[model samples]
Target: MLFLKLLGAALTLAGTARLGRLLGGRYASRTREIGRWRTALSILATELGFGALVLTQALERMALAVGGHPGGVARRAVALLHEGESSAAAAWRQAVTEASPRCSLTPEDEATLLDLGVYLGATDQEDQLRHLKLAEERMVGSERVARGEQAQRERLLGTLGWITGVLIVLMLL
Candidate 1:
């Protein structure tokens, strides 16, 4: 009975630690890049293949569709972007939430994304690149913060699990 209890504790601690660390890393990695409707779309599409489509990806798909359409794709993309700020904002918010599980994004990150949507295909190449840079900057900052917290969070969970199991064992005794 004692052996079973010890084994259970050990497995629980190990699993908890591994899961925390893995999720943190995944979260950090998922936030490595941000904007430019097409680049964002391309990355999101790739993410889709992995079943991780986020709000940003949805924007990307919309941009790609509009840009890739055979007849006056550029003109159509422009019209959609011009549809209204609220329309773009809603989509941007959705992307951020969709990716919430895998990436912890700040309001600033969301704002930057919203800005990216506004310019989207509506802007010239240089402008698009600028928005992309802004998104990338935000993501990079977020990733750094996430990476710093990841180890600490993992350790905390692991230590707590260990301590909890030990306490349980003592109580049973």
Candidate 2:
């Protein structure tokens, strides 16, 4: 009976701790994901503006250069485009929408990407560059906000999880 009780308490602590860490990790992931988007967007912008590449080629290169969810977004967009999707803008919007649930991006972050997509391949080089620049700026701001929250939230939630576990064990005892 004593051994069973100890095992139960150990499981409770381990489970709660793991849950807390997972929750905290989301904030860190969000910041990293935003940074990846910024980097990938910069690559795409360079490909479009200076490399004189078309939207499809630029996206292909961006997908190759970046990894993780951001890269996934680019790859999905490229696939959609090659599959007879009408426009880059529509492809990008659909990609972002489909990727949103799988990513750590907030609604605002998704909206920013969607808005940037709306301008892609719909305008001249200079306008496209401007929109990419705007999207990069928004990503920078979002990353900063995510960074600010990550440490505090992680610590608080991590501690709370252990405390809750202890409280529960005590009550059971």
Distance (Å) between predicted and true CA of 40, model 1?
Answer: 4.5
Cα shift from native, residue 121, model 1 (Å): 1.8
lDDT value, residue 1 of candidate 2: 100
Clashing pairs in 1: 41-60, 55-95
lDDT of 2 by residue, 32-99 (tens): 99999999989989999999988888888998898898889888998999999468888988999998
Every candidate's lDDT? 0.51, 0.90
**Which residue runs of candidate 2 sit more than 4 Å off their true CA positions?**
none
Tens digit of per-residue lDDT, candidate 1, span 1-173 = 98997787777667655665565465444344332223544443344334444434444454555432211222333344456554544444444445444434556655656566575544555565566566656666666666566556656655665666566556655
Off by over 4 Å in 1: 1-108
**TM-score for model 2?**
0.95
Error of 1 at 61 (Å): 8.6
